[model samples]
Target: MELDLFRWRFVHWQFMLTRPSNYTAGNIGGSVSGVKIAFLGNGSYAFTVTGNSNPDGSIYNSEEAITSQTTGRLYGAIFVRHWDSYITPQRQTIFYGSLKKDGSQYALSKVVNVLKGTNLESPVPQFGSTDNFDVSSSGIAFVSKDPVLQPAIFTKINAYFVPLTDFTVASPPSPIQIQTSGFNGQATSPVFSPDGKQLAFLRRKSVQYESDKLQLFVLTDVAEPNSTINALPTADQKGAWDRSPSSVFWSPDGKTLYLTAEEHGRVALFTLEPPSVTANSSSLPKKVFYDGAISSAYPLSNGDVFISGSNLVDNSIYFHYDSTSGKSNVLSSNAKNGTVFGLSRSQISEIWYPGAAEGTQIHAWVVKPSNFSATQKYPLAYLIHGGPQGSWEDSWSTRWNPAVFAEQGYVVVAPNPTGSTGYGQGLTDAIQGEWGGLPYEDIVLGFQYIEENLDYVDTSRAVELGASYGGYMTNWIQGHDLGRKFKALVTHDGVFSMVSQLASEEQWFPDHDLEGPYWKNPSSWLKWDPSAHTANWSTPHLIIHNELDYRLTIAEGLAAFNVLQQRGIESEFLSFPNENHWVLKPENSLLWHTAVLDFINKHVGLPTYSEQSSYAKQLRSEAWQNRKGDLGRKV
Candidate 1:
């Protein structure tokens, strides 16, 4: 298990990766001719792991049972069930074989399924993996998702191409789709380059916006999948860069391409080079490092790179960089070398202000409170983030962490409103079809810029939390006028209607941000629905909802906790039923951060987990890390 297996990041491999049993829910990539494993497809059948080279005997199990759904009655679709099981036609195939070295024990011969009866399927649902497929000694580029549309109204995906066969041949090799030099929609992170004849991917043309803008295809020769496609800046090429990256790595010598994007609110690191193999630049992609949020980039073979990042009071760091003095050197950190998660970087800061359009500009993140003080005032928290096109960056987060609510004496903030995402894409497409109009006026101007310019924030002792579309803007500011200024509100797994979000299975995200299918556009989603402004309900909410989320499903948190319990307001619902749409176990994230910090510490007066403190009861501990460099990883 000490596999350097011949350094892959800098490319120098041979092959031997069969040590991670129990199948593989993702990532195992190897292909000078074998070893490719990736798991999970179950709803009925799923298994794919091969390594052919057979010296003889023992293990090789590839179970696939889909005798064509023999009637269990389930039809009319847009994804039978998505972000948490159900869709079962038993997809996810890829099997290949050979690795028979007998004596010291080894076996897995003949195998097969390389898209067996080709309609193609792969690690592409609920976000695919093993970077959606690669494998080299000549062929295997993968990237399914478009098994002929309908998976919630389209986002293409395609990319195919098979060609290395040897399962004693007979059926397998019609794959070939890779012709995306015309920038198709959704294709996704293919990789391949370090001499697999080239193949780097990331595409997007919006089959109805999934936060479009990825475009960065590279495919020369690829040994053949409709080969030669040198497209780099051609959409009327001349200055193509409005950025939207988030994936694309390779540069150890495939002539450059680093990517990663999400700029202003930070996620940086760029590099590219495809203006027909540039030697003088102009195909854009060149921002190489600009302070934190990196999330991986390896490269190195002299043109150094390493990287690993985090911020907002640090949870990890490790730099290196030095592409000949472009600067970055800080080789290790968990905030600081000797480990002092008592957090720092002066308790994080960065604001920006004003945005709801006209002269736009919004981005927030503030934190403070590792026992912070300048004549203490604290108690604000705020926090609303959940990909209404995501962005409350300067990283570090293990679910709603603003330094664990600034260690609970509060002062958190977090905004990035106007549909976040490293700012700039016209304020992230100004929340497409204007979600509740201008990200709810950039979150009521980030709570009127912390109730009119912070003074150690208090906002009448605020609270407000959020999940999924920040739980539909905590059920759209509880009912608006920003729920008469929150003293409480949480909402995980959000969205409570717009025609019960057609029980979500990703209908191209409410058919492009609630502008199309609610029975063919129900007034663009009952015009910014929070159950259509429930006669401005009195807020004291806290409805968590999970039951395998299915993207805003558990009946949108039981219709906003049965309309705040039949309008008598003061709500509270919290379900889990084995979680989904996040609440990822660890004793259910310490019973969801002790039921969202004890219902926002009993509505902001503070101290509730039995009158807190003991580092807020070591965030529900097993002495298993809660402070100091925070819960290991999951930023």
Candidate 2:
């Protein structure tokens, strides 16, 4: 969409020469593929395209092979499969074309590959998008993982500056590397200044540890002439900063930088001057605003910052903050969160309980049902967050949402344990080599704190659930004392074995978390292995695994389910073959929720899913049949 800033509206709405059916919508599935990125700049346009077809629009023969007849994958390298899909000859790449005029609308002409001659992939696989690349008037800067490194065990992604010479160059000029002073991690979130003179990005020190602190850097003299095409341009790094920034962008004046980092379970916005301005000041980076999670903060030319964010109750909110006046004006929000959905800020709160470690306080979000009453006890729905490095932030989510579960007549307590981010880096780093030790104790202590203090929460009738790392914790709980406390457990895309987890595509993850290879350090992996305690597994379990979850793989969940069955423990297996790590489709999400809720409801002695729905239906049916009499009696 091209906007006319002067008029504060759109001039030409359609940018595509030929409108594609759908890039991401579930409906209208025929003759469609996804458009990952569509960038318009410098009289040329670029896009990241994904499909089974070639440049000539010819479908690949390998993709058309008969799967039922004969099939086998023979490969010699790591990352043969990453994230969701198996390795294919074709990978998603950036394509560029001339910005042509289609009547009154601006559109892209027939395009050519940007990384044609290079052994690089843009919009980095699995979890990257428009932010992975930035376009300016002179060139395009993008971050791609080390082409020669073993992606399974190493993580080093560098930002490349492509000085554009032509839109249809068969092989574009060799892209130069924007060096980050020997940083060995992904140089992500590269953002070009408004004038295209400078590029700011974020990088880390450790390649293997994905959760390492992201240091901010700015590359100056970006448009300087270079005789050597792929020359390395040194970037200025911010070393004194303690917190890792997730997003980075230049201020409107181009003298300062704005960043957002997770702080105390909140994504706070911060502003810092460039090193050249004044580097040694203790107050270099100052916190701006962080009531809820600030997803985006755009500095206006007039000094006000436009921001968008959400909290536990509100789904979405937009506001503009004027630092001069120190005031925030609400532009828009999901007012319907309360008016239509009957949700309120009062229903959600926070509790900081002592963790297993002395002086270690773990934060948790406590959500009560809309009609909660202190006189009555409510079943506890304890939610564990994934990422171990990830925290249950003050934000809204579509999946594993605490609000949705609370609305279903339960009190949701989602805890951010020892390893959770947004807290100090020390707590997060402490989880290293002790994934199942201290963090597990933090979770246990968190529950114990609730049981002993939260009077209205019935911990005995609780359902503990989580996905990914949280899933791994639930699996760990199944073989421990905490499993006995919950009525049932739900584990989604979780790891069941420590040794078997090395089979995952990203070996660097288990490598770092477990400290080393299982063969080299057996105790490091074995001491925390969920499989080691299978002899103690007696809890009712709902295991959910997807076929495309290459992180943990389906084997983990299947192994857990088989163990449950062999032990004659009450368990059910839920599989989504079409989905990946998450249930994306609407219908699939509905099924996922139903299966999970039904299993938990059954174990907790609450009404089953169908029973709850049927009872509600019966009430409506009886009221409908006697509407006239009911109205007359009421009158």
Candidate 3:
């Protein structure tokens, strides 16, 4: 049996198993020769394809071909049936079974009705490695919507266990419900301990709040039908500790659980040992590794661990961590030569400075030009990340890339301020409802610190750029005292008015992040409203808005541009009528970069190659011709 890599997303790898001899032998009958098995991300379902391999070793090319195949299967399928009035809601039935070849077709064996309900108020099952389910030799542990909760104001998710034996029998036994009493929030990523006595999972209070942090929990007596869940005490619960924790691995002794968590500005490794009930000892989680952001980790039988992570200067790289030496050795990387984005001489470094709040520290990434020199002053491009809850990770991004700015002879500084993840939960939670308070202060102070400390930086030639939440910050900065700090500003798909943003597609973001709905607290809505301070705007601005940006809505960008035009500020509006919140298409992205770089060059001096390079000349000519054509048509 050979397992071939099918698809990879984030840290999860989906595989397809193939039996080479079975295809040619035609043991399964008909045109279909082999069984192709595929597993979903969260193991919610497993699909099988029973089809013939072509000359090129590919199968199931079309819908007709798939239907004509010898067999097909869908495990753990949920069926919904609607009845009565349209508002009465629908009934759901979950089915689980194995597929077997049955006379030129396929049949489900040991078919089991795992769950059935009318008006089941539960979250849709998340089929991935991080979100919902895991399977072991003993049983299958999964996170499912709690059917008991009604009205579904906030869907409550709970952990469930079904014995492996139940699937083999004609009638499956009722799944054992692992009660999460104290922690009645959402639960996910259930991983059984090596001894099978305890199960570890991540719990969040509510789904309404985007900033809600996931805490680690270990359920004792997991074998019992009713087990008690205890929150594992960690050294830094306040810091977004264990925020988005996944890929749980247990030590060989079953005494310690190792997992990857976001801390400060990186996704590092941490370990937690369940406290003893008799001794009442403190069993806090401790940081075991601090190299960079770890995407995935797997423990080996020999006590060593394999990890895939990236630092401030590199992309995804594989490494082996030695348990005894406490050292990590590089195994492989896409850019093993230490070059990134084909820029061999560029450098990246993490810079820490005193945060806006006294005694607090802020972190940011600084990308220097490939030909950086201390004697000459360089223009700075201060990049802000979206997701006031998101971070400037030690990873590479094609969109909003700092390296591109660096390649253009500009030093880039991306700060992970308050509310950014990977830091402790406390810092992440501090920015909620105070969007323009601590987080804004952090960004301003971060720039001030960089300006004061970095003598090679030309603060007067700086340009501030951001998208999404970062765009919101850029809007806020344009109206605040910090607006005078930068020579030019760029806001893309950002929120302009807090109250108007309530009309966004995602209602939960404003409901929780902004404290509540506009009706509930009208005054709070005006606190971060950039429209209210348009009188103070004086900076040259470039506004980018997309038609399909339902998250922040195109209206928000329109409102900001209206203010810029009304205030007579030197501004330009770049609208992507065909794109969404993000400009993803190749041609559109190229146009975006060209326009943005042109705007920056217009304010700050152009790079040395801008006038000489044929590509730059062609891009400028194309832009000019398009603008002239638009003006001519209007006349």
Candidate 4:
């Protein structure tokens, strides 16, 4: 083993691209779309379908989990994004084919078939570009771009309709012109109406505008060339970005449209009625229902809408008002376990996690401070979750707190933005490869949203911190911008150098390789590489990690500390030799939290030198050995 280790060091870079055979569930797209979940496999796969059959009379080959119901077709990304780049069979094309009863398969029966374009000879690119595809009642519609950088403007909404004979050659009739002149803003949250005749989408607000508003636009005859479209006004006359209109779906009746309004730091479900043109050719919108606490809502074809609430304990339980029975039961009440509110009395408002963004209905929890008072201004600690895929569920977290942060005179805003799961495939796929891009924007915008709309926050005194991926983001944010916004930062076991992470021959190296061969695309890796711009980092930071964490490894933390020292930055490093990916044990957690409080106090203008001195000394000795290049040296 020692000899092998030595050999690995000599040629560590060789194993940089040796990733797992294929992307794991981690690489799978986010939230489940329709009721018919799909999966991708290398021709060998198995699944079960209930009360469903393919056109070929075979039981559907289901692999991925879809969350919609009987009447509607679901959509999911075929490819997924990896660390610094995109992956393919991209989310749009990589779909699993379900089998029909008589042993026949649908168009997407096999993973290979999904990857093969009309021309089955050439394999698809494993990197670059992000797209979402949908097959509506009318036909198949795909949202793609000629150049990824050019706003993901909706190019063409396709319609493929043919009789049973032409099913084999089902091709699009023609391209629909949604935004012909090109939407001034980027195209996001595109959804087709029930009839597939019209398309509804969110036009993101520009960066210069300092607003995250989205406006709802309708493209009628979307599958036809030179179609008519209109950006409809809401009854409130408010812009969409603030409360960006999303999760847009036409009701089963098709008379009303359901949309989520996420703005003013609140997510509400709103129902809209399209305008009727008068002699002046103007239309009016009427509001139906608004539920602010329900920030993210999805309407199911079963006449049920699953809305994620801000309450910790019951954050997400399917909800519906039985118009017929006048009775409602929270769907899956059995799934709720007081996991979100372990502390009992804490009033959690929302929750956040690793992959979510602002304006995104991420899973999060907010607890009012103990002995709270409206007159008091509180501090904040923006807590982040790990996993770039892990969720900050209603479950108890050993990490940051709603009550604890609030008790510490801080308000916490945890948002699960673009990359978070439990939402659906489209939202999850959006964050792939866009790690630093969309995720960062979501975090910043979420923070800004809280400061603007929430009254209890003390923005100037807020701090940001996280572990693993969260730590990586902390380091990324600190290096990118620190205009005294975050009073302090704590990053635990974060990857500081993409170059080192790529070169290391560890268990993680293979999984990390899922990003694609760095040799093939250095630009993608650089885009999310925190170490690339460490030279610009100036924020006081606390580096924490477990000595035995193979996932991130101790060397990564040391590298970050060394870089900070080299730059004369105010920082400290902490480690738990007995811990792993997380500081799990109770004693370790207490110590960890104590150290964190001490660090925050010192950095947030309160001194805790006496309490932190001993730990500081211990870290200095350990850090100094590495600093002086003494440990790894063979004297």
Candidate 5:
């Protein structure tokens, strides 16, 4: 059924693109006359079918349709803006935009501000809409700021609602705050039940040591005019913290709620069942879908769902999950098309290995060479991800593509060890204040596991590479006994010293990860500081740093190179003066990749320079000059 719908939609889109003469100019400025299909948060869809010019020179909507085919209903449009101008100070606000439908034609109301003269500061209010607003059926209840209270006492932004009927006049009514007893952090992503009697939202708490922990709450009796908006008691489950929950959606029956969160290294679907009683419940949220991290999900009236996410091999694809059969079917192409860029024929697989502790499992992604054979050995390129709290999701990346390594005849392994998100919050928080502890051990064990299990992987000819947190890990690896494990190491924009890294622009990162300032926890700084262990470093290294990287600072990379050079250890530094922490420009990226590949090839016995690809040779020359005459040394 979804396949047919997709085909029809594809045909319609193609037809709309071909027939340029049929589209008339819209009042909204751009050419928006074509049928633009937009999915609403209420599990339904809307489209601007056709447009026609009115007799008075103004354009009138010839056809504007909303689908009532789903279990959800459409509310009036809500427009939100981050108003930062001379007239209004920097503040985030939502406006009510009424919808008037006449036959197939509909008109949108002029936006009326929901909050007027409200001095709300940072940690702004969210209307549960990144794309479309999460509004009640009557278009009255919407998520906004609690305007009655100033941001001084309540430093955290709280979620509130304003009814549509309150905007009969020019001035809008004050929003009613949803009260959560223990939660004082910002509230966002409010999802109203289909019956419009209950509201579900996430409440987060600001902690000094780590990220804000989010807990799901449902407000009952929301329809009552003078109801005391108390959230139902929820369980405080450890390791259940949400890692980037983007959207909140309720089932058609309103008994179940679905959301996607990073759990143990993938974005998996979680289901929460609101307790029947108001008392604190011990029912924990269960993970329903485990295939991959679901970026977005849209539920249908017939208990089925449409999801978009990435897996081990493929990047982004659409799937339809049948609730009855408990199975999912692909609805989109297996791989993206139309790109002529010669990508390698690589196969990706998810591998689980023993972690730092016994019986503990760590997840890693392996990308093998195109013509892979068990009889032939291949060098390994270990790629680490950033975020310390981030995971190597089964997603495609242009910057650190593992396939590119495979194209060079090297097997690539990307791991989401301890402290990586998508596993569980407990695992993510494990490395807090212990950056070089369990996570490092996990990476070592992951590599050892691959060496022992994969016969085709030549671990002795391996190179470890990473950027950001991964860079820090590479630096950390250089200082530990693991330095002897790899033939070479590459660090890009990595942290060299804990105390020096404190000079980073984002103080919150070190503050949260290190458990406070360096002065406050000098022991923590000394324990894992890579600079402190430079005496143990012996491996050949390549250091890459960007001048615009204020996060780790250019000094971090320079310091690492200085130590290696001062000690007479084989080392090279490549500086990108015009780039940031990431080399984003196309030409710069080509140079970066060429330099990295050259370094890897020199160590792994591959052709250091490819004459067949003149473009690559030219990039290698440019990158060598950027090395500041250091290319003469044995790489």
Candidate 6:
């Protein structure tokens, strides 16, 4: 077999937005034969044609981009999904190319560039931040910047028609207008109907900071924007800024539009009939369905719906019927091992993955006490997710610290609430900008559901814990809803004040999040700041943050801690000296988990859980043996 190096510069390994970079292999199948590895940069990578096997034990007789960098740097790069890759002579980078299982090459007509001096001003870290183009199986339609249109949010968020064949963008493309002056909110999820004739999207015309309200707009076009179009605000739903739609998806037939909205912090599903190509604004909006506290809803190919709910015991995704059974089934109930056990049968509590809420189809693991018994209910620790848009899946981690708490008799429950991905795009965008609102309610309701439904859980001994966005929610609970309900709260790398997060990292504000900077709308910042209710905090809190975290800097954590202390509230602050946003080193992770278990135990009156396990003891013993010669003499 002949092997081919994917690129001339193996050292410059590039990561794709959707897949891993096995540059050693020219294609997605595996390493090719006759390829030799060569170092392009001080051995950061190796371009070779040899019989090198991957982690799966398959011989990879091809080139490889192995990391020769330090763990801190390597892990950091992988964390951000940036890798080395070749830059084309056209000055085009892989960032514009699409790679799929089948070899096919397609490029964007023009890359979306963040205007200089804009929020996307910061250069990507040592590892680049830009993602290589991703080709969707079905073609896509986007709104692009045209000097004439001058879309308010961008020069353009182009609506290039990506053809499924060869996955190429159509030439002389048709474009749409996404942003215009006086728009309250940014444009979100542009979805075309199944027939590709109608389009639906959620737009915020304006965002009010104090009340956290947004003006919603829905535009429809029968053919293309170039043709006659019917664009206007939706009158089907109330026009209140406080209750704007978050996610919009079209049915397979293009007859229905599914939307998720937050009402008093609870999410509900609403189906409406969007205006047709021939119909004008005269069509009335009708709600075909409704579910209070619906976390997420996904549309499947067959028209069945997969809904990941926020209700307890109902966290799993449910398959709703259009023609099939009216009820949904739980997919997570199929996993056999609820808790992972180590070599000695001692439960490795941290190894547990969570399942979806009880009735939904999604699945996640729960870490429970090694010595726990049904007779003695345990205090529950709810591990909140950060991305608020990310999912809690079954995977291994060295830092989650679940086992440490489980060993101490704490029932650790991590839920894949609404807004988590892997379910579908509709579910993923359900909580945009509605922070401290429905997003917050889903979590609280989840905890309540677990306490009421799970026989092994004790409501009186519950705690709320999370990092980053999860951290933000933990702090929110301390001041808004669960201040008195939760026995203790633990926030890691979370935001206390949105104003500070936006101001501290101004360069990141525009592109990644925030329609504009804090200065443009300072009230939005003040309204969402958890510290605004600091005077109301009653639960003891433990604030953990990394000194070097660029996302949520230590200063943010310190400010919140200081205010809590000043108010005579019970709070403690702990900072990682050399770590970043996520504490990755295994030893450091052990320490972090141990400290969390200790803190929660102290507050909840549970017995202390030792951080040390048999694995730790064995590692220490090996270390001592290696250092025996330095002892000078045996004791």
Q: TM-score winner among the candidates?
A: 2
User: 164 in model 5: Cα distance from truth in Å?
Assistant: 3.5
Q: For residues 1-635, could you state the per-residue lDDT of candidate 1 as single tens digits?
A: 11121233113222234443322122223332223432111211112343211112112223322255465757676677788888754565556543433553333444456775666567676667666776655556778877777767777787776765343243557788888555557877787776667777777766667776676767766665565443455555321677778777777777777878878777889887743433323557778797768887778877678989887767788888887677887888876831377777677787888787889878787877877887878888887888788787787767766887787788888887887776666677668778788888788888888777888787888888888888888787888898788788888888866677777777777788776777776888888888888778787787888888787788888878778878777766667688899987776776678768887888888877635545435554532342446434321
Clashes of each: 13, 0, 12, 59, 9, 56
Every candidate's CA RMSD:
24.1, 8.5, 8.4, 15.4, 10.2, 13.3
Query: What are the TM-scores, per candidate, against the unseen true structure?
Result: 0.33, 0.84, 0.77, 0.48, 0.75, 0.49
Candidate 2, residue 584: CA error in Å? Answer: 1.6
Instruction: Enumerate residue pairs that collide in model 5.
Output: 140-164, 263-422, 263-423, 264-422, 264-423, 264-424, 265-422, 265-423, 267-293
lDDT head-to-head 3 vs 4, winner: 3
Give all candidates' CA lDDT scores. 0.69, 0.75, 0.66, 0.50, 0.65, 0.50
The reply for model 4, stretches above 4 Å from the true place, is 1-82, 85-131, 147-178, 204-213, 233-242, 275-296, 300-304, 310-315, 321-404, 407-488, 491-540, 544-560, 563-570, 573-635
Sort order, TM-score high to low: 2, 3, 5, 6, 4, 1
RMSD of 5: 10.2
Candidate 2 per-residue lDDT over residues 465-495, each given as its tens digit? 9999999999999999998999999999998
Q: Give the TM-score of candidate 1.
A: 0.33
Cα deviation in Å at residue 241, candidate 6?
A: 11
Q: Looking at candidate 3, what is the lDDT of residue 52? A: 26
How far in Å is the alpha carbon of 302 misplaced in model 2?
3.8
Q: Tell me the lDDT of model 4 at 302.
A: 68
For candidate 4, the per-residue lDDT at 112 reads 18
* Candidate 2 TM-score versus the reference: 0.84
Give candidate 6's error at residue 403 in angstroms.
12
Model 5 residue 472 CA deviation (Å) reads 0.9
Q: Candidate 6 residues 176-282, lDDT tens each? A: 24433444333445565665455555443333211122232344543345432323343432242234555667666666667766542245565665654465434
Better of 3 and 5 by lDDT: 3
Off by over 4 Å in 2: 1-71, 100-110, 165-171, 224-238, 277-282, 299-303, 335-337, 614-635
